[model samples]
Target: MAIHPPAQEALTPPAPPAPDRLTGRARLVLLVLCAAQFMVSLDFSVLNVALPVLGDDLGLSRSGLQWAITAFALPSGGFLLLFGRIADLYGRRRMFLAGLAVFGAASLLATLAWNPAAFLTGRALQGLGAAVIVPTGMSLLTTTFPEGPLRDRALGISGTLLSLGFTVGMVAGGTLTDTLGWRSTMGLLTVAAVAVLATAPALLTESRTPDRPRLDIPGAATVTGGLLALIYALSTAAEHGFGRGDVQIALVLGVALLIAFAVVESRARTPLVSLPMLRRRTVAFGNLGGLLTFSMMTTVVFVLTLYLQEVLDLSAFGTGLVFGVQGLASVVAGVYAPKVIGRIGARRTLSFSLLGQGLFIAALLGLGADSGVWLATAAVSLASVCHLGAIIAYGLTVTSGVPNEEQGLATGLVTTTQQVGLTVGIPLLGVIATADSSLYDGVRTVVAVAAALLIVAAGVVATGLRTVSSPAGAETSPAAAKPSLAAAESSPAAAKSSPSGD
Candidate 1:
């Protein structure tokens, strides 16, 4: 007879809306960001083929040629964490735009360089610009696409283009140098940077941590110095082995500096990178998987390039063709990897892909002096399929469940693994290949070793990730879901406290 009390469902506020579809504008944003990443990667490889010509024209000594690369690698890998945190404090859009400009100007300098000094300066500046672009671009991507299938797919596409850019650059580098001259290689980067710079400012909205924290100066100096010294040692060792006095000195200095940085972080009010973030099962193991995949896969490419050219008597162009096939395979695998992650979860996908990549790399053990070029090509192509999957899955795994405010730091770690792995892996493994009596034996030994490492890494990642769920499913462990330092420090209560208070 009396009006019934409102139902409990009606008493509660309506449920929050689900994430919307990728808007027309979101697609544009993705295009611009991915373009920037592509340019960074393109520049990295595009210079490889032109190095000899550039050296002759600019009177670069053998040491100068090596410096050309080391100069770039040093800052690109070293400054990533520092710049990432800076972007989190300042505006990401501002940093990103500035990076594009620096990269463009540097490319122009290299294009017109009249001497070795000028060319080296341009290359070094390009690396510094890349350090800014990589993390900022990746952070922009994760913040823009809310976590789920949408984010997974976006990362997949980005991964596809990134790999493609490197491969394309390798091919384009040789062609452009031979046809248009060596300067065209750097000129290509100038054009690509300008294109991305033109579009990015329009689509990207500014994003950063709400509370601006003081920069971590001590943490920055120690980590950046550590990375620079570490990369220098490894890069030098790649050419001269570990016995050099400089390599030994740099190695010791790097280890000591990194240890000091750890001590600094434990005591700092606002650490550059949160120790807890690194400890997260997903973050730690995800990055490990990323490091192994990138290192081994690139090593495989290096070994095959030698085998193709030195052993099989293939020309440079023919070698490029072989890699072109592998690049296509990567594209196909990247396109479908998101769907796989959606089904099995990123953890499983990462582990399985690493395993697959290992098995295919092991197939290269069959390559011989008389072996057909197709054999090496087939092995690399198949391995690349798994490589691309691992790349996408690793990115998804690393960035999953991270808060938007700390996306810059998280992506900084992602990109650090990527750049360091690429830079360090070749040199580390190249030592093994060079140490053996014969080139063929050395390559065989290297592949065997790479396979072992990949398999071991797969086991380790699988075990670490056993209990964790995928971001696609929106499930994660309490430890991974816990607020990171940056997030915690932003809170009113945490502002008055420090890490020891916990």
Candidate 2:
């Protein structure tokens, strides 16, 4: 029989079945989901660009202006995990819609804010809404696009939009603030939220964990409180040296609560973050790499934003345009990330990206009063390519081997670290940038420290992390054991496959 068959047929490989194309309504659902992600990402950068003008209108001191960011950071960064778990228990669609409504309402309040109290409160509320929206929306995405090539492309596009949104927001914030005044920036988000609310509910399917686990209140409280205190302490230390009594108190309280949180998580029947998940070196180191990547890159951006606007007297719009260059590079890096990972592996890619990012940022030391704007632009944008490449890789690394039952928790953990790094960046780097005799000197100091940290993070991840291939499996919560509503089917973009930057 072997001799009778043609040699080619004997060695023939089976052809794979064709994957479903994202057609018609499927495309519409993805569009809606991606749009929401854009809005969330947009909000991150838009407000920062407006801070100077907004602070002036509110008569805030340099220190008081920080509350505008800190208020938003506290709720958005702290409540992400709590909200992520809630979305899994309750219906994801229901939570996503509710989140949009709250975010819209909050944006409206900030739009017409008459005082600092009103403005800060609105910012905090908006943050709360974002905390709910991000995880639920991503969950919807994971449920819609089944794992494989289809999901990879969908996620690729989503990841690209996320990076692009921040850059677009910076540009938009500048123009809007310059023309319509500072309030217009907030007003724009209100409009975007209203549009999203009108169309999203009709296309997406609902999903929830089958066994609606009891909320881990103790774990939630200590962790959230701890992060809030930690962020506050850092920001306070930035403005008022670390020696300040308030900073010291906050620092101490934050550490104590976090320690308590670890103990609670170890014992909880259904912990918010299972201790064992972190035993996976890839997960633990991936998050650390993610944290350092975001913290350093964001700090560099903050410093440049100030350098362009304050040191060199560039207009807000001008500053935005300059950063826009970096955004383009980030997009390129994000888009091609999967191929890069496939070729070299996630661990090595992460290590190389971190090292590259450090070198690019350190080169920024040349930026000063006398340097050309183009030179600074090139360095920042190149560094962004490296930064985003690493961030996407880290996301993949963290969620690689996570089971479906704990996908929400795993995703939440990644988002939480991202938020923390983002919150910590401006404050921690701001401290270094402000510590020296001059702003220029401070900028120099910030870059040097950030560069060194990146190298250290590279060493940590390269030597310690490992690749984890996802296996076929599904876990339904107790409530979800019954027939589930058929979903469009999605796996996280960065989970099964790597992602690209830009």
Candidate that would win on lDDT: 1
Model 1 lDDT per residue over 94-133, tens place: 9999999999999999999988889889999999999999
TM-score between candidate 2 and the true structure:
0.85
Error of 1 at 141 (Å): 0.2
Poorly placed runs, candidate 1 (over 4 Å): 1-20, 479-502
lDDT of 2 by residue, 39-134 (tens): 989998787678899988988777778788778777888888888788888788899999999999999999999999898899999999999888
Residue 51, candidate 2: alpha-carbon lDDT: 88
TM-score per candidate, chains pooled: 0.94, 0.85
